[model samples]
Target: MRTTLYGQFVAGTKTDEVKQIVDKFKQYNVKVILDYSMESDISTSITASNNVHKSSFNTELDESNTFKIYHPDERIFNTNMFNYIKNSNTSRELCGQSSFIAMKITALVRPLVLQKLNQFLESRITDHNLFDTIDSLLTTKNDFTHSLTPNELGEISNLLLRINRIIQTVKKNEGRIFIDAEQSYFQTAINKIVIHLQRLYNRNNLLVYNTYQCYKK
Candidate 1:
């Protein structure tokens, strides 16, 4: 399976191997879209919470518990962003112009954070139109931190800075970025953030593209 499924899909784990594969693709006039695959979804945390509740009667912290939660700190997320940017720069170096970078907001910011933001927006914005809600989110003067608590405001700010760093790398490399979409529950927040990036960086040229699932309503 590793030689077939993983080998057919993944480029390589090492820089030299990946460069060789990327160059081979370039020989066929194909551009690379490098994606950082490490991510944690909100549903994982929810399931862990359920398991923890189920084990509440134990009254002791079980070191052998298999269901660990995913609450990554800002430092861990920043490290991930740094590695992502480094890999993206390497891809640009190997593939040159027209190469693309694919990134997920959930990878940069905590999925739970996105879930909270989505819940807040859904509660505040009553409109059924998705675009309308996004526009409302973008136009807000408070930078979408109006009703958020201090810690949440800090998280949002850090999340924006991380995204900006990624986009800035794409702009510097003269490459484009594809903001990968998430599940329906997280899509609204992702859309709002990506549109904000488009407004900022895509004024002169199309550099940021937001991906949407066609099968989704």
Candidate 2:
């Protein structure tokens, strides 16, 4: 690990070690942006037929139905969320106030699910009500899970929880977060989530940002 690109670009593996490097940069007035490097394990293509379950939002879901769609294991996702919260807190402490942290939506939610959601959103891109439905979900004022299957809704709920935790940590520390933009296939879903977060948090301060790639078509 110490002989290749990972060794050269990665700050360090441990918190203390990374802090040492960050401290050096701090001496020169350079702020550090910490990002967990974990990527989703799934890379298969999404199909149009795999649309979200259109059942009523209050419909009860059976255990068998949970895995009928794309969803990561509960333990794994929770662990990642915990690590994200802890890492962000540590990052804030290491870098001091107004620190910056980078996050990937793919890290919290399955990529295939994102693709499916993106496909659904793109299909309804011209519908103003669809956007209003999404906007209402920012503060949980209304239920938007009606458009998603129970499994997809659960996954999205978990993702929102994870992101909310991270956002609260960053806010308490007076730091900002940058949500990384992914491939075109998933960018639409990512943008929606980030924008909602921006609406909730940026109303007072620019605590959240969405990244745009110039190279994407």
TM-scores of all candidate predictions against the true structure: 0.77, 0.79
For model 1, the run of ten residues with the poorest summed lDDT = 60-69
Q: Residue by residue across 116-163, what tens digits does model 2's lDDT show?
A: 678777876777555653535433423435455556666666677778
What lDDT score goes with residue 69 in model 1? Answer: 23
Candidate 2 matches the true fold with a TM-score of: 0.79
Per-residue lDDT tens digits for candidate 1, residues 131-210, read 45334544453645655544445566667777888889988989888989888888877877888788889999999999
State the local distance difference test value for candidate 1: 0.72
lDDT of 2: 0.72
Query: How far off is model 1, as Cα RMSD?
Result: 7.6
Worst 10 residues of 2 by lDDT: 61-70
In model 1, which runs have C-alpha deviations exceeding 4 angstroms?
1-4, 46-72, 126-148
